[model samples]
Target chain A: METLDGYLDMDLLRFTTAGSVDDGKSTLIGRLMFDTKTIFEDQLESIERTSRQRGDENVNLALLTDGLRSEREQGITIDVAYRYFATPKRKFIIADTPGHIQYTRNMVTGASTANLAIILVDARKGVIEQTCRHSFIASLLRIEHVVLCVNKMDLVDYAQERFEEIVAAFKAFATRLQIKEITFVPISALHGDNVVNRSANMPWYEGPSLLYHLENVYIGPDSNHVDARFPVQWVIRPHSREHHDYRGYAGRVHGGVFRAGDEVVVLPSGFTTRIRSVERFEGPVEEAFSPMSVVIRLEDDIDVSRGDMIAKPNNQPRVEQELDAMFCWFSPERPLEPGRKYLLRHTTRSVRALVREVRYKVDINTLHKEEGDVQLGLNDIGRIHVRTAEPLLYDSYRRNRLTGGFVLVDEGTNRTVGAGMIR
Target chain B: MTQSYQLSHLDQLESEGIFVLRETAAQFERPCILFSGGKDSIVVARLAQKAFWPARPPLTFLHVDTGHNFPETIEFRDRFLGDLGAQLQVALVQDSIDRGRVVEEKGPNASRNGLQTVTLLDALEEGRFDAAVGGARRDEEKARAKERFFSHRDEFGQWDPKNQRPELWNLFNGRKQTGEHFRVFPLSNWTEMDVWQYILREEIPIPALYFAHEREVIEREGVLLAVTEFLTLREEERTERRTVRFRTVGDATCTGAVESAASTLEAVIEEVASARQTERGGRADDRRSEAAMEDRKRQGYF
Candidate 1:
């Protein structure tokens, strides 16, 4: 394998930036990109021209990320805007999600793929409802790291007590959520303090700056490397004159380590086979690991198609018909209707599913469970039981986010109505 | 370091995109790709080519011709498809203006950039394409950054940013009702640097306009605009010959260039490395407002 020095050596970290509409999330992202010299000359010129036209004193750094016309006019984010930046230390993908309550589903989408989530809180408006809501959604999505960025410290005269007060309030609230890691930093995104570089204003605070934390945060061991699972996406056969008998199970490895001669079992069918070869785009590799896309040719060709799981013969997932899991309802037109048929997509496999029951609705603000409502509205998180027509190979979402998660599609409309994480 | 036990960033992104493309093809009865002759769409095109290899690309490429594109991009598009033997469908904006589907702006420097959406929607309706593959990366714009990989458009081809489908894991929901279409972005996960790096590594052929060259240009809104027929300089507006190149290509009227001396791809790569503004910052259409791209996207402008 070839590794380039400057760009390739820096690890990639995906982090979502969440804040109330006025908490300066966009400006912070803009500052990061600008300080890192990621912005091009044309973009800077456009921002300057637009700033002069808008009659603003200084170029609105937030305008760099304010991509939608409505969002700029309204001065509020309505969706998740993803921004990317790279420093010498690491590459970053920032999912800039909206702070409004209605856009909680967007936060879920962003957090679903993020390694860390930056929850922004205005220094003046310390620990508001949207802050809790964003944190709850982060925890619900199982995002591992949470960085509480207390932005607009300049508004508070760069006082350490104000930052401490906000941090205490957040820590108290976060205690209820099931988050593994949390960090707090005071920042002024507009003035570029404590974002990319260490701030001299808060001499009392000794922790690293926001950029340093993002760069050095441990995310390399996030994937499940112990339990081997492969959900076959396609059967690759070049099918030409030269390579006639090529049969490769092409899929992204969801967990654990897979070797050339590892004994494997095909799910649902439970047919056993030994992996003959592990191939990537370059050539046949000696070994394949979790999250890598490799085509595996089995010694014996059993009935394997898209959606079928292939794992170690001894470390197989439980094949089950009933699933009890947490789900975030995504559709506005339709609430989750019990006893209705919906397509349940897990990995690459889609199966007909019946929503048997709605266990309870979770309150984002108070962390309380509301019982007996039996209705799951848009952005509503609830526990439900579902029965699939065919058995699904799965693990607990806590164990593996890749295989344990699934999305529910409305059978009639074919719209994705909800996202479920297996229990 | 022990070999990282995970998919490379690009491969992980590619696998997810391929899965989405396949899901879109399997779920939608009629699907097409919105080919803009850009790197983002080109990546999507390549992914489609690889997605269903041995078999021809399952869908057709839909190009909305503003008739103001660089001759090189159009030529590159035709040749690339010819090499793949893939089908190409052209929807002319001038035809839409002639048929009264959309009105052409009237001014010394009026552009058909915004009106192309009407032509594109008309083409989609005419072809009954339920899903249109687009090269829109979320990193381009703020509202776009919030956009899902599978963006659902209403019957009138309007994007509802407030209401989007929840995309979790690698499982993308491409399922939409009749009369509604989806804009699927396989390169949603890629950054601008990543795109350039991939192009450099794969040795992908791009339009010649990307490399810097000296041209008759005028400075407008702080950007060097190529002096073309679509552009009419006022008596006060001065034209000067400057070495410039385009980061993004669109309707020749709206797209602007920056003064650059990077004549080779490697030099251009280094130039991109030190830049501090976004590539879209040069385009006049997005310069209209902060969220210009988002508004255009909501209006079904690809």
Candidate 2:
């Protein structure tokens, strides 16, 4: 039996994939899972049966990811589907999203929590308009790492010049975006070249395979640790007999390090106190950091409830009623217009907000701003000014994604209409 | 005072599960955790305990009993709930059958797994529960791969796979009409291997059916099924005593067992890690058709 130590110590990495209709995105994901031996024998049999029934010559690897019946029948992905696989080094979560123009909202949803993105570019077509649009979305969502997979290299005869030309063209266009790290790889996902193992076909290429890069990428510094931010989600006040007057603030630490005896301030109320203890289910800990859920007990009693934020007194978030942000409209039926009221939810707080003005709309394909189109329809990206009924504690989205992001809800239909990032 | 800031995969998954549980408590007026005495639900129940430590979770435990469950599972469920000091509401398939709410399938291959959906929906309506927290993981099946953490259901308790709301970041939209409810899955990101590893790490108690044991069984269509009164045997089918363990717990008629000697938690984890077949591969319900799970989920099956 294999030891459980390696499995227990493995970390996690979440990445998103983007490609056009014919870029073979599903095939790429399937290849990664298959070559790693993560695909079970039963699943392979099922896919093989389906492929034979569809009268395909070879086993269609894409059949593994197209889960929904509609997707299988129409040969298109309709929404986001999550897939999982693990190696000895790390566990991976793939947010496989559709690549159609109208499915921009789905891609945004997938990219919101991802640390990296894999954008597939067909070798025959080189970089096209769809490539630019996918890259822009990745930058807009603040994904730090990107792997540009030039797929179907077998079709291009594994030529070194063609791969270099595509890389150069993509690099020139990428200068406009704020992507911090970019790695270019040439692979043929259909024949399983350069996905999991070194390909003998492409002897000129000298780099780690796609899976190797994913397992070794430095995502430890991806989370913000300079500023402390915690949005209280619940108040745990057990009315049991053993302990009375036990009030603790329950939340997941958004950023920075929090320890016992540290001075902190509660937002909106402006009450300051010292942290008495930082406790998890096991016991009290010395310190807690980003993404760890724990209960914090303060030295003094104060009015802290749901939707309240706790942060260090020295480093506090911006408290303002009027704010500027970029909005991605999600509702297909309605367009965002000035002077309209909606419910804006930020952190844990929700309040009424009005759209004051539309500054400009971004043409994602060309990376150009159209100042004349003031209204944002479905899948349109634009900057707008919003005035809330209550002041919000936030930071610029470029600094902290957890504190600076929000969703707008339409009251009438009770549907999430838009997502915003603080500017 | 110096430590790596990064969390291990298990710790991250635990934190995410706890966060979702807390969100469920704060957002909905009334919620319940669907307990099946299976490893997945057992892990969920433990997370709920940690999520609201020093206090019993405000949510109740609801079990949709199919009357075809293994006796060991039902016994485990009762004892576990007694220890947790939480409330439990059992919706019985037998009661639904008595009321003619649902009809039982007849033949050599009859099972009440499909009948549990109607009883579950009826119980949710009667209890007026706004959220039903389930222990479903996306990696368990193909159709479940697209499920959201906060899955919305209409008033009729039907799921629309086509028109789902876009879930972004940690923000979940729980707003709904009066009669409509939601199916919240805290374990949507967990894989089968993760579930077993968590159970081993936390020392959570589960039904003995998960460990190797001797029981009367019959081999049908390459699946080792427990020989219970709920199952009707054919002329050629013969029962034999075998040492086996179950990978998943469900209706006795559908859940299958595998031959194994891993009787301890460590042994089970080792078995799961090295196992080549998917956990649900042994389930007979999923073998009905290519879209069996999707079709059942659309009609409000858990």
Candidate 3:
């Protein structure tokens, strides 16, 4: 048996895969899990049975990921399906989404929380419009890392020149994107080349396998640790006889480091106080950082409540009634028009907002901004101006995902109509 | 001083779970945790305690007892709740059957697994719970892989899998119309191995059935089942004593045990790490059909 200590301390990585229906995205995931021995026998057997029922030539690996009955029947993924696997080094969560032009909303949803993206490119097709669009979405979501997986090397004779041509074309288009790091890997998902194991066929290509790169990627600098930000989700007041006056503000740290003695300011009210302590279930901790859920006790409680943000006094988020943001329209029923009202939910705070203006809609294929066509319809990405009824305490979405991202809910239907990133 | 900002996988999962728990508490007027005395629910219970430390969780635990439960699991559940000093409301499948809300299956392979859904939905309606928090993980089944963090149910308590609202980032939408409710799963990202490793790291206590023990069992359709009063045997079937442990805890009729001598948590973790079959492989309930889980989930099954 392996040492339980090593398994307990491993970190986590979340990445999304984007590819056209024929780009073999599902097969690639299947190969990764298969080679890593993560796919259990029962799951494999079920898929194999499915493969036989469908009368496919080979055991269709795509059957493993197309989970829904509709997806299986149509042989296409219509929504985002999350898949999980683990290596000795780290655990991984794959947000698998389809790559159809109509499913852009699903891709955006998948990329929202992803640290990295794997954009698969068919070796024969080189960098197509789908490649550019996937890369653009990854960049728009502020994903730091991207892996340009050149799939189906076997079909192209594992040619180094074909792989280079695709990589060169992708790099040319990616220069227009805001992605930080880009890596290229040549693989054949059907034949399992350089997925989990190094492919002997691609001897000229030198790089870590896809699985190795994923397990070893440096995501340490991904989170913001310079500006302390905590949005209170709930307050715990025991009010019991044993601890009558326990007032604990519970929240997950969005950014920076917070210590017991740090001076903090409450948003919207502008009240200042000192942190008495940061307590988890185990007890009080010396410090807390991004993503850790803790209860913070303030030296002076001045009516801090839900939707209120607690941050360091020295550096605080901007307090604004109007927001400049990039909006991705999700509702197919309605187009975003100026002067329309929406319930803007950001960082636990929900406020009524109006669409002040539609600046421009970006053509996802060409990355061109169309100022004349300001009507943002379904699956359209555009820059819009919004004015809220009350002031919002927020940071640029590029600076912090937790504090800057929001969703627009249509009050009539009570559905999430759109998602936005503050500029 | 420079410090590492990285959190271990367990720490990250725990934080995410706590965040979801807090969100559920703050979003809904009345929320309840669906505790089943299983390992996953046990872990959720522990996370709930930590989420509202020093103060008890504002939500009550609702266990929809199938009436075909392991005696050990019931004892464990009661003791665990007593230690936490939390409130529990049990909705019995027997009550649903007696009240004519649901009918019990009969025959040699009869199980109350399907009957639990009606009882559960009835309980939720009776309690007027706006949100039902569960320990269901996506990695467990194909249908669960597509589940949202806050799964919305319509007025009829049916899940519209094709038309689910898109969930993005850390923001979850819990808004719903009256007579509708949501099923919140905080452990959606946790795999079976992650849960076991977490149990070991946190030293969370689980039922003894999870550890290998000598119990009388009967072999049916190549699966080992505990010999209990709820399980009816045919003339051809015979009971034998075997050392086995359960991977998952559900109704005694449907939940099957694997042959093993792994009594310690460490041994169980080791067994899980090297186990080839999925944890749900022995579960007869899921083996009913290809889309059995999806079908059940649409009808308000947890």
Candidate 4:
């Protein structure tokens, strides 16, 4: 590969930004694009033209990401919009989602794939209810890295005392959360302060700029490197004359690593096999690790197919028919109730799931457990017990997100009504 | 340093795209690729080829021809499919017009771009296709930025922007009701620069019209339009000879050309890196209004 191709191979960091609509979240994103040179001149001109049409004196940077017709008309982001940018060090994919508390499902949708999250706080307001709600959701979703961006520092005159006060309050509240890493940065998105480049006004604070930190964040060692989890997505059998009797199990490695000649076992069947080779269209790879999609040829033709799993013989995930999980309801049409059956899809496996119990709902704002709640409504979080028709091969969401996460589809409407993280 | 098993951005994207293609095949009963002879869809075809190597692409390539495309593009579409020994299903706008299913537009600046939607929907329903893979990129348009990898549509094949399903991780929910379907875009994250670079790397052959060529063109509304059989010049429209290349291939009547002397893949990449306008900047269809793309998408226009 050439140097440019090597550049193409740079690490990717996906993060989500959550703030109250019009709290400069879009402005910060626009500034990142502008400073990174990701925005084309014509795109800027279009935004400028729309700003003029909207009768704004200053060109509104928020107009750049408010792409939909209704979103521009309402001047608010209603759904999640994905934006891509890159620096020389790493590539970034921002799932810029709406920040309203009512749109909590959108935030979860964005943060589900993120390695980091940015929860913006208005410096003058100082850790409001929406901020707490976002933090709690981030925690519930198992987002490890959280950066509390104290925005609108210009409104507060970039005072060190004010910044410290907000940071202290956020820290006091975040103590109950499950975040593994946290950081703080005071920025003014409208003026591009401490966003891509550090602001001269904040001479007292010595943290790296947002862009620098995003580029340098340590994202490796994030996946479960010790446990190997491979959920078979597809099986390829070329019963051709030349290469007849060739069978391959194809799937993306969710955790750990697998090399050729490694001993492995097929889940559900508990049959043992040795890996023959890991193949891509390019050719056979020396080794395959987490998140790499490859076709593995096993030495033994064990009856391994889609919805089955492959792992080491000694290290195995729990095989259970009944599971308890934290579920976030997404549909506003109906509330979840017991005795209703759903199509539970986990990793590559799909089976009939019967709702056995609705234990309790959690008020994320107060972190209170509301017992005796029989239903999980839209944007509501609750704990429940589900009985599956078949045994699931899984891990805890805290251990491996890919193997532990699943989504619920309403059998009648076929709508994906909720997503669950196995406890 | 330890052997960090992290993939580069391009490799990750390739893996994601291939995974999406295979998922479509494994999930849907009758799925097809919406081939338009454009560079993006050509990349889609290439990715599909690499995805199911040793076995032909599981999905058929369906071309929604507007009958106003560049001759070179049509030829390339046919020749490429022939080379792959794959299937091609062409849905013609003329057939729709002839059958009175859709009426042809009249007067200047009238294009079949919007009319192709009806023909496309009719063909899809006739074929009972449950999923259609396209090459729409998020960076290409504002409306597309909000598109899901597996965009679900109603039974009418209409896209409801407000009620889109939330997609997370690589676990794309391809579940749909019996009549409805999905429009899967494997190139949702790719930009014009990424496509060109991948083309240069994979040695993917595209239509010759993508490179610079001498053609008689006319300027209108600040965009150069290639003179073709379907294009009838106005009284004030005067043709000029110029070394122009197309940034996007579409209806020759609406799709515009840019002045360029470079004809190779490397030159195209260099030009794209320094591009001042988006690839759709030359496209007049989107210039109709601020919400033109959004409105068209709602009506099932790709």
lDDT of 4 by residue, A86-136 (tens): 777887889988888778889988989889999999898988888888999
Candidate 1 vs candidate 4: which has greater lDDT?
Answer: 4
The runs of at least 3 residues in candidate 2 whose Cα sits more than 4 Å from the true structure, single-residue gaps closed, are: none
Name the candidate, 1 or 3, with the larger DockQ value: 3
lDDT, residue B186, model 3: 96
**lDDT per residue, candidate 3, A1-423, as tens digits?**
457888888889999998868999999998888878889998888889878988999988877888878778887888899999998898999999999888899999999989999999998888999998999999999999999999999999999999998888888998898988999999999999999888999999889989989999898655799989999999999889997999999999999998998999999899999999999989998889988999999999589999999998899999999999998999988898789999999988989999989999999999999996478999999999999999999999999987889999999888899899999
- TM-score comparison, 1 vs 2, better candidate: 2
Query: What does candidate 1's lDDT look like per residue over A193-256, in tens digits?
Result: 9988889988888999998898888886667888999888777766667677777777778898
lDDT for residue A160 in candidate 3, whole number 0-100: 98
Where does model 2 sit among the CAPRI classes?
A: high
Per-prediction TM-score, chain B alone: 0.95, 0.98, 0.98, 0.98
- Where is model 1 more than 4 Å wrong at Cα? A1-5, A22-27, A38-64, A100-102, A121-132, A152-176, A237-239, A243-247, A372-374, B6-8, B52-56, B92-107, B110-115, B216-241, B287-295
Residues B19-101 of candidate 3: C-alpha lDDT, one tens digit per residue: 99999999999999999999999999999999999999899999999989899999999999889889999999999999999
Worst 10-residue lDDT window for candidate 3 chain A reads: A1-10
Cα deviation of B187, candidate 3, in Å = 0.6
Better of 3 and 4 by DockQ: 3
lDDT for model 1 = 0.82
Candidate lDDT scores, in order, read 0.82, 0.91, 0.92, 0.87
lDDT digits (tens) for residues A1-423 of candidate 2: 356877877899999998766899999999988877779989999999989999988898888898889778888888889999998899999999988778888888899999999999999999998889999999999999999999999999999999999999999999999999999999999998899987899999999889999999998655799899989999999999975888889999999989999999999889999999999889997898989999999999889999999999999999899999988999988899789999998887889999999999998899899896479999998999999999999999999988889999999888889899998
Q: Which ten residues in a row have the lowest lDDT in candidate 2 chain B?
A: B161-170
